[model samples]
Target: MSASVTSTPVDHAPRVPAAPDTAITAVADMARRARVAGRVLGHAGAEQRNAALCHAATALRDARAELLAANARDVAAFSGAASFRDRLILDEARIEAMARGLEDVAKLPDPLGRVLAEWTRPNGLKIRRVATPVGVIGMIYESRPNVGADAAALCIKSGNAVILRGGSDSINSARVIHAAMQAGLRAAGLPVDAVQIPPDTDRRHVADMLAASGLIDLLIPRGGKSLVERVCREARVPVLSHAEGLCHTYVHAAADLEMARRIVLNAKMRRTGICGATETLLIDNAIAPVLLPGLVEDLATEGCTFRADARARAIVPDLPPATEQDFATEWLDAVMSIAVVDGVDDALAHIVRYGSSHTEAIITEDEAVATRFLNETDSAVVMWNASTQFCDGGEFGFGAEIGIATGRFHARGPVGLEQLTTFRYEVFGNGQVRP
Candidate 1:
């Protein structure tokens, strides 16, 4: 996706007030505003919401220079791994992608007011289940600045008001992005308070959001495991958890060696910092010697390191030994853990033991084997002959995702427009009395 818009240096900073006396008070105030805005937005027509999304996309493109400048400040201030820096930095292409994402979301069918199901009772009562907005949402995410754009776009299209609280690492970028979103809302004659961010990136603010049970209808924490775990543990509100992405790519015994090599390399090395990137390589022991060496060389060429089990070390002696903890870890970098399994069953067993249930892929040409892998592997997304890196909201064609949920309830995989809504029953009754 791309946007072809030129930008000039200008300050389009939004008109936001200072923080309140306490984080709790600030969250309360923001939530109140969002709740009020949400009621108006929910009743808005789909055309109006789509217009807002388009305007926001244009606003983002118009503010490209300012957005990049803010991101540069964020990138400079960040003190983390190279992979994390990659997640934080935004260039011309990424900015264009963000703009395009919003436009794409605008083009999607509106999620609200759809009759999911309808039925009539014997008493002549008609009832229909209709989709509706999830109301005010609290979005807490980390360094990826594009997350703010994606979340806002999805929320606006789904007719929900959102309050974004990005991590300090990317707060500058988030603020500018938030400004662009507000500009879009204002242009469409929607309430600007419909989308907001906290006054500052303080740790206490997270607590404030987490404790806002009645105000924030739903809380989504999209970041590292610690962040998700903390929110799940303490948040008084309902949470749609985006857990650690300890994804896997398994090379089946019936796999094509060449295809397996390509899939494994892309799954692990294509932006290794992303949650969808494969962190573990499970290969069948029958073809470990023929396929493992080539796969290792391919990833190693791309600066990937490995922690190998003893069985794998026998195939390649120089590889570092892997421990139980290493297999269970989510290494969001150019590092992977390898293990040789007996076959598909052993692979599935290993996954059941250590996997995060986010995404798992099997490389095999045999239809039966692929079917079993796809059916039996317990994950939000299961792939055959594909890269685990394909586990993205944009890749899934939901415009853009707020996050890939690892949990089973509410939503799984990419949390997109439809997933952001709840349902209500609308009934049409006759004037007949109860018999």
Candidate 2:
């Protein structure tokens, strides 16, 4: 999808600050530096860019322990509730994963300068759409320090500059990762400003990034609903915004009970704090009696908590009552909501009304049912007989992602290296005239 203006701006609304003005100004200056660097990067050879990514991979691997140590400081200093603590904590495995992501990005083909499409007219006019970097990107995210590395690596690989504004809770970790990325850039004889983490941890800087529409080509907010909503409402710049992941998994009557059971358990409990985790399980009424009981019991054994509708509660009397909010919530925890729909139509209707249009799945043996679900679901990623967690970019073999965009304009699914690029028309003409 291409970017374009949709409407006129209105009154200013209250926005969540990303940092203090002093810090915001420093970051803006850093971003300006990166923009200059990006001009060089945009023309840099693919081999040089790959070399930088290779260096980043090595730096990340060598600094793994130091990175983890820095992350530990952030985790220890976290004063928020349990949920915040969960988001703040990072371990050796997560750090290693970040390094691996950088290495994988290094392996992918460079997206910059590649010719996407071309055409020639009868009047001897020719046009080619070539991929180009999207310029400086301001990523405002929360808690997850690993995102800093991921965003930096993806932007660098795609030949775009990046400015990261991570949550205050993860300042230390973000700093360490950002330093490693700069080291990689310098090692490849590239400008260190190519990847920057703002010195300010105050919340107002997010506003500055958003308001600097001419400077930041895109503002990607990669956190919860409130953060994304704030960016969408306040940012004058274009936003590839993604809100909640109130994802769903529908178990149709034709579904294999065992497969449905396993998929549901994995989808909901494998990792609950991610956007792709299934928050609601929609079971066909025909299969609800036969499959619901076992599914609920299976999930319970895995330490999962559930809020069930009347039908589900009847089947599993010990289940907690499901509320309206439960159906609409993206419980990024060990909690899930259950409802029994009449059939495929009801399931589709329910998802259309309540889903966040992030990821949705259907478990069915009938090809027609599965096909319908896939075709009808209006989400960035849709699946049949697969877990919602598969919506991730890494799983889709893109190395890493900026974030999963649920919008229709620029990108819909995983915003990976390819998604980070915008196409420009390259035209060639031999004495062609408009007349």
The most accurate candidate by lDDT is 1
lDDT (Cα, tens digit) per residue for candidate 1, span 86-141: 99999999999998999999999989999999999888889999999999999999
- Against the correct fold, how does model 1 do in TM-score? 0.94
Give the alpha carbon lDDT tens digit for every residue of 30-143 in model 2: 666777878777778888777777777677777778778888899888887675577678787777788788888988988988998888888878899999999999999999
Total clashes, candidate 2? 9
Look at candidate 2 and tell me the lDDT of residue 157.
Answer: 88
How much does candidate 2 score in TM-score? 0.93
Q: At residue 169, what lDDT does model 1 achieve?
A: 97
Following a full C-alpha superposition, what root-mean-square deviation does model 1 have from the true structure? 3.8
TM-score of each: 0.94, 0.93
Worst 10 residues of 1 by lDDT: 2-11
Candidate 1 lDDT (Cα, 0 to 1): 0.90
